[model samples]
Target: MKRALALVLSGLVMACAFGQGNPARGVRRPPKLQLFHEVNLSTFWHQAIIRQLAFSPDSQYVAVKLDPVLGTTELVIVEVLTGKKISTLRSPEYLGMSQNDRVQWLDNQVVFLGSYYRWNALSGERLADAPVVGWQAIFNQDRTQLATVENVLGTPSYLHVYDTKTWSDKKIYADGLSIGTIAWTSDDHLVMSVGVTRKSMGKTIAGHQIGRGPDVGPDVALLLFDPQSQQFIKSLWFPARARKTAKGIEWDISADLMLGISCFGSNSVTLSVNKILDGRTFDIKQFYSDQQVKSNSVAMVGGQACSADGRFLFIKDVDSWDGRHKASNSIIDLALSRQVASFPGGKEEIASSENGQFLAFGGKKGISIFLLNGE
Candidate 1:
């Protein structure tokens, strides 16, 4: 009887810690968030760093990748509601971007990096290593295909596409090097973060600069491409980084790779936003009070997330140069293009469910699953 009572008490404590407190008892505050599950890497590894937390399509589970500690990494999948460990995969080294590592899911199965390994979350079944492994993998909005872009010295980056279900390399493109990062347009076309120098029909193509970012190389532009024909479609130089909305994505433009008219005073930088619905552009121009002229560049917007109703847009922006690489997020009222709330972090590992119902924040200590109230 005593042991059973202790177990019951422990469960109650966990519920409250997850923000699932009873309203009658006043256990939670306003806009209470329910913790779906929790994961602290220190429990299994002597040292752990939260690298990324990606939720499955159905939002039933989350796949977490811990940074490679002393050269070994672990990927753990846990049930969102029950906090049950479905499976775990170990990688000999870091996968993709070491700092912002990620995991991709296909048809609910979790496909991770490490010896080209794949695991099924529901069955806990592990697939054999593939013939080849690609780095810097990204998925389309529909999640039907995955693309791996590989860059080599003195050569253009190559992109390898894999069918999500069969994990087969379906297409290969040589234009990957032109892309700093990639996204999908509203019409199922691929958009790339590339600059003035480009490739069209295996020849050099250049753009007459109407605008620029910092005054060095070419300002990174969102170049649209039709993967089916492997042809370049169009390019736009606004909205530094795009996320969920407008079906258009913005790419980060490093100061070194951007150019403008008077990189001298650098008083203010103008950023344009392309709205998908009505084809309108919103300009967000701000002055650089924190940095010198040489260091002042376009405030790079990194992450983009939209609320379920598309009323609110979340933008993560870094204002200055390396003097402070810190990122900040502002909740924007889309209709007004005004900032509603501001927060400190915009660089941490975060993931949202397909349905935009939940947002997961991964930290060094653990992962926290919070219900998205869109507030």
Candidate 2:
């Protein structure tokens, strides 16, 4: 019996030494993080309202949208290493509607939403002028196709598919459901959030209406659709209390994994990361939840993006309603299920490169980039 007990103790020590036992759990250290670059918005445009930050495919340059006070919206390209402005491209038609411009990088070209804008990287010249009316616009993996959610009033919401080469579009899905956000999973598959809003008379209290007329239901659904075949593939429903409020839902799609942030009820929010290997099976994991965040506040993931390699997820926390409050943005190592690093300040948007080497964050103050190392 003493020999057997000695053998068991020896085996337990061996497991811990090999890093294969419960003793090593929760003791793993986080990855090392370092700040690489920071670009001041005021240096490029005075009092510029920065809208979007997109890194080039090669991580050499970054595209920035600057809404100036006197002129039209400008798309500026800057060298990542030196923080020097390379070229500034302007669109006269985008003067009044600068807020709606969503810039996306497609190889050497930058395509945006307003006026169906497409611009060249080297020359800063407009390539196409096909106007598409939508809020969330996403391009496919090849940049040849574009998908957008058209939510016009008094009509059923539709998914509009466009061909970038011919500047032609078609309304593929015209269901009664209103789409909050749309993203491309691949060249053939797309994912979107669908919800419905209903109106009812509010109770009169002290000769005043107590509640708003429109009572939005909390039955939101995330669906996967095949854009090539124009067919519905699969869907996953949200919790009954998880409805989209003023700050609409946001999601990041990287290969087979999707991370979604859903804000529901008056003060409840949840972040769900789903792995959809096949169109039919969806493996979902709720990573975070906040029960105290107000409804009017922006969702925690309003400015979130995933690394292209699907190894890391970055999120900018909404610490306070006022922009002055300092918040900690986190870099999560998905495989380890732990936060690797956190940055101080309220970063409005976070983006990473295809190779996961460079990360960029944008905010009211300015934009910053970091080089991820020691993974």
**Would you list the C-alpha lDDT of every candidate in the order shown?**
0.51, 0.56
Q: Which candidate is the best by TM-score?
A: 2
Please give, for residues 1-375, the per-residue lDDT of candidate 1 as tens digits.
Answer: 546644654575455555543345522222223454556655654545666667787777888777545666778887765666777777655563563235667657756553256677667677665544555566665666666656553345566666666777755554423445544433445545553333322333324343333343333455555667776655455433434546455344322222111101111111332122211221223222223222433224443445544455444455445465445555545445445566443245556666656666654466766655422
TM-scores of all predicted structures:
0.62, 0.68
User: What ranges in model 2 sit over 4 Å off?
Assistant: 1-32, 43-45, 70-72, 93-100, 113-115, 131-133, 196-219, 238-280, 292-299, 322-325, 336-340, 363-365
Per-residue alpha-carbon lDDT of candidate 2 for residues 1-375, written as tens digits (9 for 90 to 100): 546644654554344344533334555433333466667666454656666677787777888776665556777787766667777778665543443456777676564535367788657777766667665666666678777777764345878888877758878753455666555653356666555433212322113232332333224566677776776677665433434556675321221223242211111111342221222333343333223223322235436666655545677666566765446566665555455676665356666665555667775556776655432
Q: Tell me model 1's lDDT, rounded to 2 decimals.
A: 0.51
Q: What stretches of model 1 exceed 4 Å from their correct place?
A: 1-38, 44-47, 96-101, 114-116, 130-133, 165-177, 195-220, 237-329, 333-336, 343-347
lDDT score of residue 46 within candidate 2: 67
User: What residue pairs are clashing in model 1?
Assistant: 157-177, 215-258, 215-259, 241-250, 242-250
The TM-score obtained by model 2 is 0.68
